[model samples]
Target: MSKPRKPKGRPVSGWLILDKPVDFGSTEAVSKIKWLFNAQKAGHAGTLDPLASGMLPIALGDATKTVPYVMDGRKIYEFTVTWGEERSTDDLEGEVTQSSDARPTEEAIRALLPSYTGVISQVPPQFSAIKIAGERAYDLARDGETVEIPSREVEIFRLTLLKCEADRAWFEVECGKGTYVRSLARDFGRELGCYGHISELRRSFVAPFAEDTMVPLAELAALEKIEDRDERLAALDAFLIDTGEALSGLPHIAITEDQAHRLRMGNPILLRGRNAPVSEADAFATAGGKLVAIGEIGEGEFRPRRVFT
Candidate 1:
């Protein structure tokens, strides 16, 4: 009998904007895509809670290095808050802790939204992934331990009341990093004199990606039904977004081939005149339209902070 070929994973690189479905954790979604692409390395820009569904950008290979940039980008979410009950975890997954009969009117909800806009202080939910002394806050919360998560400053660029019903309200928010939608719901209820928790949460976009680029897991699963393995691999590869695209928000500087080589070797390059940015300003250095490195300009020198090889 002929010997069978080994199923070695491929060395893939790029970002995969996954439309993470409800009930799927961010880690599990990364693992699924990593297995599908047979990528050598993989990570994600940010975490999408299990109860929330939408854009979860997965980075393969070198793309993982640019995760910080993407994670720092603003996020947009559409969430629904069902009033009358507050949960221990701040979402439907937790135990109901309090109840109220109050429901805010559409006019009332709209009035409160302006307050949420601009810079605001938000206390993260106790049942969160935030690490406290090497242990997850959620883990400690589950064990009946009181986890005091301090309030932090987060920017909310915009907040809109989409709908208001007798027992529930829907809202859309555009906010900076570390802003939790669940906390918004809990606080919103308190502001309106009604206890509430998130019933539905969906992230519409995560920085550099939109609905057009999101690939549903169902679509990926369908590719496996293809009889030809080579054709299937080609189809899967088509979904990859170039790693350089993740740095689109940053300023770009085109460098010479020699400069690219030196940057890749962990060396600095000199820039003069308009090419040199203000001191300490980070920018993407590219060569022939391909990313060479992400570096900060200081004293006319582009020092490589993260080099892409």
Candidate 2:
């Protein structure tokens, strides 16, 4: 018998970059979109907390296969550090755990911003999603269990102090994957001999995805609720990054057809082509108008990294 045709008006493979409104988690946004489109498969580039807003990329269709590449890319965030207060979660949601009578000076904050522009060790907050003892760290913390989260080395490629007052400062940060803005603020406060916590946060960019391309959740929701099919398609296009586009984001490399075929076979795609591959995880590998996969340089050859799954 002939294969049954798929349902008409089904959503094609794409990404949806939603400007997550405050109080909405990234997963919640994905769930809503999945229901709205009746998608069979979906995922997101990164997880955003309910307190944060901006640039949450939801992957749809086969593009969900590329979500890991986007998730591992560098991220940029704009945030405000409010001094004279320390919260249990290192953000606004938690109760005040500490405070200082002293306030931070604009000059002091300006001077310290440069120190964070490079590599640094950050300890994930106790109230985080990290798992410990078979339960989430946050759950353990909520149960009043004392936990010691090990410090992790995370890179802050760029940290710019935008504005500063007596007790508060706005900042722009470009960091590697897994770095937490709240942790940075908490540590900054410690460095200055005062307390600090994140009061506001907006992720402006995640590597290739930027705020300009982000659609507000409210707007997307309104369109979806109204059954505006055309508008929803536009939203998907706005967020989805095809393989070719994603490959261009990384350093370009060319490979022979045999290598390309091998890459598709899930081999350890190595680094070899026009340019030497960057020693970063999730580096792009491509050639001749197609994406091979993202991989690292090995003994010799662009080893198959992430198959075009």
Candidate 3:
């Protein structure tokens, strides 16, 4: 009997900011995108809870190299805190562990905003991905084991009370890496004398990407449904941002094609005049309008740290 050959989609590269929908996990989103693109490699910068939805930067092939940069950048979130109920997971996913009739007045909520802004201590939810010992904290929590999550200092650049009604309060938070919106909602309810849990959460922006740049999964699925394979591939490719877009925060220098070839060969090339880095630091080097490598510049030489090719 003849065995069938496995299909390999294609070797693709670039970044796709997915407008992740509710009920979709980050890994599931990545898998779907990988299958759609038939990409050899794929990854996401930040982890978003299945209950939350919005900007999720998915990297393909070489673009995966820039995941760390995107993950560390500031994130903006819009969420609603539903008062009178506190959940074990700090969100609607868990059982209500506490409740109260008290609700904070708009004036009081506004006054408390400053305290959450700037650097503050935060304890991540026990039913979270955070590792405790060698196992996931969420695993221990689900097994009914005691979990004490350590508090850490996280930066909240801006925390604003957008709107507040009787049972739900809307907020927008611009925070640095490691800040949890669910935790913020939980803390706000506690501070206001009414227990609460996150009812709705959506990420509007992450680092270099804005809400407008994100494409919903439904749109991508529609594009994939196109009958013509070439047309479908071309349409899908149109949404990918250049790999260099991910390196927007880094300084760049132009190098000769020969230098680029050398860099690809794992060799360092000397820099001169304006092509030199401002100081002894790591920066991006381009050749013929294409990204060559992210290299270290020192003593008039560019040593390739991570070559693109």
Query: What clash count goes with each model?
Result: 0, 10, 0
Clashes of 3: 0
| Per-model TM against the reference | 0.94, 0.80, 0.94
TM-score of 2: 0.80
| After superposition, candidate 3 runs with Cα above 4 Å error | 1-7, 278-281
In model 2, residue pairs whose N, Cα or C atoms come closer than 3 Å (at least 3 residues apart or on different chains), thus clashing, are 15-240, 268-303, 268-304, 269-302, 269-303, 269-304, 270-301, 270-302, 270-303, 271-302
lDDT of 1 by residue, 115-180 (tens): 899999999999998888999999999899988788999999989888778999888999999998
Name the 10 consecutive residues with the lowest summed lDDT in model 2.
239-248
Error of 3 at 270 (Å): 1.7
User: CA RMSD for every model?
Assistant: 3.7, 4.4, 2.9
- Distance from true location, Cα of 139 in model 3, Å: 1.4
Question: At residue 203, what lDDT does model 1 achieve?
Answer: 89
The weakest ten consecutive residues by lDDT in model 1 span 273-282
Return the lDDT, model 2, position 73.
86
CA RMSD (A), model 2? 4.4
